[model samples]
Target: MARFDQAEGLRRMLAGPKPRVFTFLSALKEDEKSGMLVNLGVTLARQGNQVTMVDARASEDSIGAWLNASNDQTLLDVAQQQRTMKEAIKIVAAGLSVTMLTRNADCMAKLPPEGARQLSRVFDVVAHRSDLVIVDSEINLEAGFPLASLDDSELVIQVSADPDMIKAAYGLIKRVSNRLGRRGYGILVSGASEKEARLIYTNMAQAAGRYLAVPLHYVGNVPDDEHLRKAAHLGRSVIDAFPKARASLAFSRLAEQLAMSARTTLGIEGVPELGVGLGI
Candidate 1:
C-alpha cells in the first residue's frame, strides 16, 4: 500500500465529504469483534480518513489491546471528570485515535442524566475532530441502542456463517427494528468466501424481509484468510503486516465503500452540515 499524507488526507476528507460514524453491533465473540474493528479502523485511517474507534464492550478482550494502545483512561473517565475525551484518546496506527470503555460498575448501570450529558459532550468533541468514527459497540438490543451510536450514523450488524450466529443476528435485527422502528441495517459477514457470504446474506435478507418486513443491506465481507490470524498474533493489522494478503485487499475495498456510502448518505457538495444530536 502507498503511504498516505496525513495532512493531505485530512484536507481531502474535510473538503470533499461530510464525516460519518459507523456503529457496528455484532454477536461475534469478543476477540473476533475486536479484531474486525481494529482492521476496519486502521484500513480507513490508512486510506486518508481521520478515524477514531470507541471501544464500548463489556468483555475483557479489547480493541485497544489489539492495537497495542495504552488504556490509561476511557470514556467513563470523561464521564466521571477524571479526564477529557481529548485526553483519553490514544493515537494508534495511521493516526487512528481510540478510546476504550471497558466493563465497570458505571458501565453496567443504566444511563444517568448527568452521565448522558457528559457522554453527549464527549460525542460532540469526538465528532468535531475526526473524519470518520468506528464505534465497536456492545451487542445489547435488549436495551435499545446506545445514544452515541444513534442519529444520522450508519448501523452495521456483523454476522458469521454459523447457524447460531445467524439466529442471533436476526434476533438482534428484529429487536432493534421493533424498538427503533423500521430502518436500514448493513449486514457484514465474516469468516466466509464471497460466494458463501452472499448465500448467507441472501438467506438472512429473505427471512428478515419475509418475517419482520425489514430490509438488510450487504456491506461486504472478509474471507477466512490465514494472514489475518498471523497479523493478529503479531499485534499488527493485516493491512500493515501483509498488505498483499486477501483480507487486506477486502478491508481496503470495504473502507472505500464505506466512505462512498457516507458521501451518498449525507450530501457534502457544499458546506458541511452538523450531524444529528446524540439521543440516548
Candidate 2:
C-alpha cells in the first residue's frame, strides 16, 4: 500500500499526483499478449511505476491460489461498493511479486450471473491500483462482461503478429473503434521481425489514418527470441535475466514510450506537486 498511498513516490516524476492507466487488450492468441505484457511489465518496473501485469485471460495466477490473498478475502469475494482496490492489490504473489489474474474465457457458458459479476468487479479493482495495468485477455470477447468494464481504462492495446495476424488485428481494431469511440488507440506489433513488422504496420497505419482517422503506434515487439520464453517459464523478467539483449532493450524502449505517452496524455510534468521528483 505504500506505493499506492505514497503520492511523493510518483510526484518526483510528474507535475501532478494522479495515476495513469494504460490497458493492453489482445485477441485470444496465446503468444501475443503474454510476451507483450512481459516486456511492458519490465519497462514499467524500470520506470519506477509499480506495474501490475494481469493475465486477464486468466492463466491460473488467480487470487485464490495466493497465500497473500488467502490471508484476506479474494477479489472475487468483494462487492463492487464494498471493494477497496488497495487492499486487493496488497495480496501479493511470488516474484514478479505481481498480482496476476488468469482464467479461460472460452468456457464461461456455465458461469452463473453472480459468477460473471464477481469477475467484473475483480477487474474493476485491478484497474484502480498501481500506476499502470496491462491485461492479457483471451481473444473471444463477450459483449457485456469484460469489454464493457475495460472502458474504465484510458487506452486499449490490441496486439497480434505475423502477416495474417496484422490483418486480423486491424479487423479487430476497426470493429472496436466504434464501440470504444475515439479513445481507441495504440496498435502493438508482436513476434514479428523488424522488417516484416515495419512493412505490415506501415500498411495498416496508412489504412487506419486514411479511413478511421486513428494514429497507431507499435510500442513493443518480441523478435521471436527464445530467451523470452525461458524467462517466462522461469518466472523471471527478461529485463533482469537478459538485461543486455536486444529484446530486453526493445521492451525497455516500449515501456519508456508508454510512460511518456501516459504523462503526455495526462498533461503532467515539472515535478509532481508532492514536493518530490523521481530518481530515474
Candidate 3:
C-alpha cells in the first residue's frame, strides 16, 4: 500500500467546511469526566450532527474504557497500517462514534517523524468525516497533547464547585498557557447550580485575565442530579433514560449552545494546518 500524503491530507482538511474540534481537559475525577463526555456526546448526536468522541487519554479511566470501547484498535494503529480506519472507530450510539488516539499514553511521544505525520493524516481524515469531534484528553507530563492539532482545537476545561477542583482547573489553565502561549479557553462547571457555576466562571475568568492574560468563556454547566447517576448505572444517556431530568435538560441546552457556536464561529478559514508543529 502507498503511504498517505501528509500535505494532501492537510490541504483537504483546510479546503472545506472544517469540523469543530473541542478538546476537554477536566479537573473532575476520571469517572466524572467520562460521564460528562458521554452525556454531552449523546445529546449532540441526538440533535442530528455526526459526532465522534476521541479518547486521546487511552487510560483505564478514559471515556473509551467507560464505554467499554477500549478493545477497539486505535488511530495510532491505523497510522501504523496495523488496522483500517473502519476497524478503529466504533459506533457506540446512534450518530456517535468513538476512537482512541493511541492505546498507550507514551506511544505518541515515541513515534518517529514519519509515524507522527501519518497519525496526523489519520486524524485529519477523521475530522473531515464528522460534523464535530470531541476529544477527551489531558496534557501529558511533557505539557503537550497527543496530537499537535489538539493544540489548535477549541479547549474547554471542565471544573466543579469544589475549591480543590477549582484550584486544580486554574493550575491547568496556567500550565497550558505557559506552554502554548496565551489563548482563550472555555470553562464548563459540572455538578453545580447555574448561579454557582456563574460565580465560579466569573472568579476564574477574572483571575485568568489578570494573571495569565488568558480569556475564558463560560460554556455553561451541568447540575447535580441523581438521575444522571441512575442513567449511568443503566448504561444509557441521561437524555435517553430520563429526558425530564434536570441534568438531561442541561445537557440538551448545552449541546444546542455548543453546536450553534461551532457552526457560526468555525469555518474553512479557521482550520489550522495539521502536522505543522509535531509536538506541543
Candidate 4:
C-alpha cells in the first residue's frame, strides 16, 4: 500500500488557508493574556474549531499554569531534536492543546535564520493538525517582535482601556509598522463593555491609520464579567464554567467572526474538512 506523505500534506496545507496561525502581541498583564487565551481557545473549540495554543510567553507568565498544565516537553525539545511536536503537545482542556516554548523564548523573538526556519516547521506541523493556532508571543530586547512568526501569521494586538496600556499598545503598533511596513492587524480589547471596547478600538485604529498607515481590524472584545474571574480562579474556561456570562458570549462571537473572516479571506479552496467536535 502506498503511504501518505505527511510532510507533503503539511506543505500543501501551509500553501493553502483553512488552517491559520494567529500570533497575538499584547502590552497587557500575564493574567490578562492567559485569561483571554483560555476564553478564546475554549470558545473557538465550542464552535467546532480545533485549537492549538503556543505558549511562547516567558516562563514567569506561562499560559500552561492558567490551564493547570506543566510541560515536560516543549518546542525547545523539538528545536533540539529531543521530542516531536506530537510529544510536546499537552492536552489541557477539551479541544485545546498547548505547546510551551520555554527554552527557545528568546530565539523566537530574535529568530535567527536557522531558529526561524526550525520554529516555522514546528508551527507548520501544529497548524496542519489544528484549524486555529494561537501564539501568545513575548517581547524581546533583540528582535522586538516575533518577526519570523508575525510575518507569516495573522497578527492581533491585545489591549485594555487603561491609558498607559493604550499608549503602549499604540507604541507596539508603531514599531511593528515601521519595521514590517504597513499591514492590516486585528485588535482585541479586553476588560471593556461592547460600547467601551468599540470606543477603545476606534481611538487606537484612528491613530494607527493616521500616523502609521496600518489598518486595524476590531476582532471583538471580552467584557468585564465577574464570571471571568470566577472561571479563572476555578481553573476552567469561562465558556465552560459560565457559558451565559458576558465574557463567554463575547469570546464565542469573536471566534465565530474570526472563523468566517478567515475562511472568506484565505479562500479555503482545497483544504480537508475539519470535523471539529463541539467540546466546551
Ranking by TM-score: 3, 4, 1, 2
Root-mean-square deviation of Cα positions for candidate 3 versus the true structure, in angstroms: 7.2
User: How high is the CA lDDT of each candidate model?
Assistant: 0.72, 0.52, 0.84, 0.71
Q: Candidate 3, which segments miss by more than 4 Å at Cα?
A: 1-19, 266-280
Which candidate tops TM-score?
3
1 versus 2: better TM-score goes to:
1
Candidate 4 at 262: error in angstroms?
2.9
**Model 1 TM-score, 2 decimals:** 0.82
- Model 2: worst 10 consecutive residues (lDDT sum): 271-280
Name the candidate, 2 or 3, with the larger lDDT value: 3
lDDT per residue (tens digit) for residues 47-152 in model 2: 6866665544454333223212232332443443344545445423222224434224543455565565566657655655556665554334433324335544
TM-score of every candidate: 0.82, 0.66, 0.88, 0.82
User: Which runs of model 1 end up more than 4 angstroms from their true locations?
Assistant: 1-19, 68-72, 101-105, 108-111, 148-152, 266-280
Any idea what lDDT model 1 has?
A: 0.72
Between prediction 1 and prediction 2, the one with superior lDDT is 1
